[model samples]
Target: MCGIVGAIANRDVVPLLIEGLKRLEYRGYDSAGIAVIDGRDVRRVRRTGRVAEMEAAAQSEAFSAQVGVGHTRWATHGGVTEANAHPHISQGVALVHNGIIENHDEQRERLRALGYQFESQTDTEVIAHLIHHHLTQGADLLAALQRTVKELTGAYALAVVSRAEPQRMVVARMGCPLLIGIGEGENFVASDVSAILQATRQVMFLEEGDTAELSRDGVRIFDGNDEPVERELHQSDVSLASLELGPYRHFMQKEIHEQPRALGDTIEAAMDVGFDAALFGDNAGEILKGISGVQILACGTSYYAGMTARYWIEAIAGLPCSVEIASEYRYRAAYANPDHLVVTLSQSGETLDTMEALKYAKSLGHRHTLSICNVPESAIPRASELVCYTRAGAEIGVASTKAFTTQLAVLFQLSVVLAKLHGKLDEAEEAGYLEELRYLPGSVQHALNLEPQIALWAERFAPKSDALFLGRGLHYPIALEGALKLKEISYIHAEAYPAGELKHGPLALVDANMPVVVIAPNDRLLEKVKSNMQEVRARGGELFVFTDQDSNFSESEGVHVIRTPRHAGALSPIIHTIPVQLLAYHTALARGTDVDKPRNLAKSVTVE
Candidate 1:
């Protein structure tokens, strides 16, 4: 993932552009750059490191202007060098882009035939040249942008500033996310609201194939066909304090501790009333009642959230459920039932693969669609027929902590609602579940209280080369998530398998050098899980377990145990996730790795 920030105001915007890029550092980028329309010329500065380097480089230059664009580039088409940095200039036009261009090679050849020269080996440079080519043929900036986008393929969120139109900046989006921030005598544009939240909370999310023209006076929007369009400007509810790293060492650590609050906010509305179908949308109750089954689509951590939901839906609602990786689902000829509810889960809601899978499913006559997402303005929510907004706020860390747990909370709520709708839960049963739901935040806090003990375990794991995580029944997905967290932040080779599946294959990888993490919740499968632990111990594998307080598990030579407060009846998965997150956080701390922004990973996967 890359980031783009643009501004048009009455004052010097170089500082604003730089600060905005700093806010987007969580999105993960290698090189950073900025371009400003300084008087009659488009002045540019580029750096091959963090945004701080770019900011320092810009401080030395006299590139002061009222309009500018900034970019944080994650290498996709070329090497991570200063030359490949964005604000790729051609003729009088300078632009920064966020997504891939599929037709860049052909366009480059055509532009070369027309005597256009290239500087960087980037598909983004082609856009600059294409726009310049159009401007040379007597088209204005907006017209040139519309015409250039018409000839390009694939996803992109572009912000361009031109010397020909020094008073304004033009931005366009096709597949990737883009939004405009409103202010007095100024306007801002960025890939996410966090980038511009400091400037203005009032923002308008751009729809697919929409374009916008920003100026010091105001902002204007247009569709792909050059027709003027109107979009609602909504005020964002994200507090700037939520984005800060208060006393914690990193955002991941802060987010791990913030789980109690995040889960509370996510499940507050559904805790007392079970779940109101009307919270989704109009006719949502009818849609939920009519669905024969569920088909869930997601990627990465969100996919694991769906996998956990599959267990809850089938067991509680008594309906079959299937979970698919969105990327694989779109490429194959998968069977779709019109009566099956299609559910999509994502944090940013701009996940390209998941969005495409939803579209693919809809094209096959899967009429019922629901999106459980954190961002309300994102494309997935707009494309969905019903939406369950996860109040997780803005998750800044590349390794998701609060977002994943909050999503699990939402998914559990959906499961309870479905079970009640299907007549599986009577009044007493529903009240019991509601009481359990109300206590989930406290359960999460209880798990967090074990962090001091978990940190000691992390010290043992930090020096290890590999890890294996095991869980039984509904906790299996929790095991998978635990392994993913370890591999993502600590740079260890980690794998997860069902407790029963250890004998099948993964047991061979277990030894003293490998740490095996087991999630034991004292459910019906506790006895079976205990047997699985014996197999690990017999193989001389180091075992670290997170279980309920009432469990018989205790510390031994190779066995380490951290007990939670109590067993949450149906919401155990949500509580079980906190210790695993803290384990990864403390382990990464012990290894001195970048716990928040892991290498080769971004907070949001906007590109395929």
Candidate 2:
């Protein structure tokens, strides 16, 4: 993922651009740069490290301008270097881009044939050159961008500023996200609203294939058909305070502790209104009636959430359910049934693979689409027929904590609603589930209270180079997530498997040096999970187990036990997630790794 910020205002915008990039730091970046139309020249400063380096350079160089664009680049097409950083300039036309250009090689060749030179090995530079070519042919900046986008293919959110047009900026969105921020006598453009939260909360989220021109006076938007269109200007609800690291040392730590509130907020509306088809969307009830099965499309953590939901859907709702990795789903030949509901899950809602997979599923004649996402204005929700928003509220850490748990909360609610629709649960059973749902926030808090103990276990885990996480039944996904958290932040090599699969292959990798982590709730599978623990113990593999408080398990040699709060039955996975998150956070602290912004990873995967 990359971030873009642009501004056209009466005052110098270099500071604004730099500050915006700082805000977008959570998106993950190896380089940062800013280009400004300073009088008659396009001046730029780029650094191959943190935004602070670039900011210092801009300050030392006295960079200032009324029109500018900034970028935090997460390398895709090239290695991380100053030359590969964005705001790439071609003959005074500077541009910063977010997504990938699928046909960049062909376009590069075409531009080369036309005598346009390249300075960087980036798909973005081609766009700048292409636009410059149009400008040389007597097109204005807006017209040049419009013409250039038409000839290009693939996902991109681009912002262009030219020396010839110092008072203006042109921004476009195709597959990646882009938005325009409104301010008095100033207008800003960014890939995410949080980038401009300090400047303005009034923003307009551009639809796919929409382009806009920003000036100090006003903003004009054009649709895919090149016709002028009016997009609803929204008041962004993201609070600047939420983006801050307060008492917590890292955003990840703060987010892990915020799960109780996040879970409560996500389920608040459903609890108040009572679960119904209408909770998802106006027509979700009708869509639910027609569907006989569920097909989930997601990536990374969201995919794990989907995997957990598959068990819930089949066992609780009695429906055939399948989960697919969004990136792989599109390339495979598969049957798309009209009777199956296509459900997409994402935290930011701008996940490129999942978005494209939704389109692919629709092209294959899937009749229904539902998006369970955190951002309401994001493309996935706008494109979906039904939407259920998770109130995680701007997860800033590159590694997700509250977002994943809140997604599980929403998916569980979805499961209950579906079960009720199919008559799988009567009133009393439904009421019992609802009561558990209401008490989940408290259950999650109890798990959070175990953090001090989890942190101690983390001290034992930090020196380990590798980890294996195990679970049984419904918590298998939780095991995978636990492994992911450890590897993601702590930089430890980790893997996960169902406890039953220990002898299948994973057990061979276990030994005295190996650290084995297990999620053993007091569910029906606890005894089976305990038996698997014996196999690990027999091999002398050290075990770190997060179990329910009422469980009979106790500490012994080569075994570490951190008892989580009482399991909430079906919602136990959500409860068990808290301690693992704590373990990862504290372990990363012990290892002195960046717990919030993990190396070589971005919060939002906007590119395939």
Candidate 3:
């Protein structure tokens, strides 16, 4: 995921574009560049590494322009160098693009035959030249953009500014997020809402194949045929201060607490159960029932959701399910059947690994394809039979908190839906499941209230260099995620093991010096988890249990217990994840680490 911003200023806009890019650098920061259209011509600057570093390099120049576009790159088709940075300029037309132009190789050959010279090894550079080529042939900017898009394949969100037409910025999207912000006397364009939060709250989300021509006065959108289209602008409630890392010390922790609302919004993305069948409409249940099996591809937290879904889908829907990491899914020798369904999940929907995996799976001719995504109009969504979008709005934290929980919620709901379709679960059982699913928002909200207690709990263990995480079944993955989060920000050496794995080998590491964080949520594994805790205690390991208050094994001899209100199935992880998030937050704070922007990690892994 790359972050792109373009502005037609009623106010001085350089500072606004730069500051916005700073907040969004978590998306991608391999290199950064900006191109401003001065009255005379377009002035451009480019540099490699973090945006702060690039800004340092650009401090010597004075760039004054009312219209401009900026991009922070996560290199995909080219090496991370200044030459490959975005805002690629050709004949005074600067282009900053996100997503891949899949036909770049063939298109590059044709352009070379036409005597076009390229300076960088990026698919984006091809766009700058392609647009310039059309303009030189006497096509207007909008006409050139439209004609050039006809030959292009795959996903792209492009912002083009031309020196010849100094007042306007041309933008188009096929499979990514693109927004136009309406301000007092100007307008703004960005890949996400956070980048333009300070400029204007009113935004129009560009639909696929819709081209936008933006100027200081207004924005005009057109359909693929160059026909004018009506625009719908929604006022964003996100404040500038929300983008800031406030008193809690980290955006990750703040985002974890936002799950209650994020989940609510995700469910609201499609509320009609009785009418207008979601994603899969009137014949959804029938088609799903006929499908033989499922193949799922995702990465990071989204992949964890897939792992959890396999359990639920198999048990509840009686479907054979296979989950693979997006990065590896394509390279392996996969077994594909025409009756098999392919499912892809991503929060940004522009993730490079997942996108590639999705295209490859589609090429195999699956029975059906579905995308569970947060962004409604993205590449994967466009290439699917159905799309179940998670409306977890604008997760700002580099580490995905709300996104992971909401993805799990969607998968959980889908499992119940499939069960109802297959006649696997009875009405009483199905109602019970849905009823518990509905309570998740309230449960997660209550868990967020335990943040202060979690902060206190973090105090005693921050100095420790190593921690152990234990759980069983689904909580096993939650333990892995907890350990991963702790290590991700706190830089602690943490390992997760199924509680039963203690006697197998992990118990060897337990001693008085070891501090273990046990993810003992109330489940079928609680008794076994208690036994694992006792073994750790006998060996003098400091134990911490995140369990329900009602469990009979309330207190270990020398261990600390962080009790939950009650133990509920499927919803426990949603609640239990909060305390782990808080613990990671406070631990990082105590250790004086950058909790919001962790070292050596970007928010979106757009590059493979």
**Relative to the true structure, how large is the alpha-carbon lDDT of every model?**
0.91, 0.92, 0.80
Select the stronger candidate by lDDT from 2 and 3: 2
Candidate 2, residues 559-606, lDDT tens digits: the string is 888888777889899999888888899999999998888999998899
Better of 1 and 3 by TM-score: 1
TM-score of each: 0.99, 0.99, 0.81
Angstrom error of the Cα, residue 607, model 1: value is 0.7
Poorly placed runs, candidate 1 (over 4 Å) = none
Residues 1-608, model 3: lDDT tens digits: 58889998766677777877886876746788888887878888888877887676656787767888999887788888889998899888898998889999998998899998889999988888899999999998888898888778977889999988877889998766688899988999998888988778898888778898998898999987778998777878666766775775456776787788888876653444511235454556666777877888998878877888888889878888899998998887676787877889998877768878988887776768888987655557767787787867667776778888888888877777777766787878866776776677888887788877888878876888889998887787788788888888889888989899999999999987778888887678788888888899889999888888667655646788887668878667767877787788888888888776676666766555
- Clash pairs (backbone) in predicted model 2: none
After superposition, candidate 2 runs with Cα above 4 Å error? none
Candidate 3: lDDT of 148? 85
User: Which candidate has the top score in lDDT?
Assistant: 2
In model 3, residue pairs whose N, Cα or C atoms come closer than 3 Å (at least 3 residues apart or on different chains), thus clashing, are 1-606
The true-versus-predicted C-alpha distance at residue 157 of model 2, in Å, is 0.8
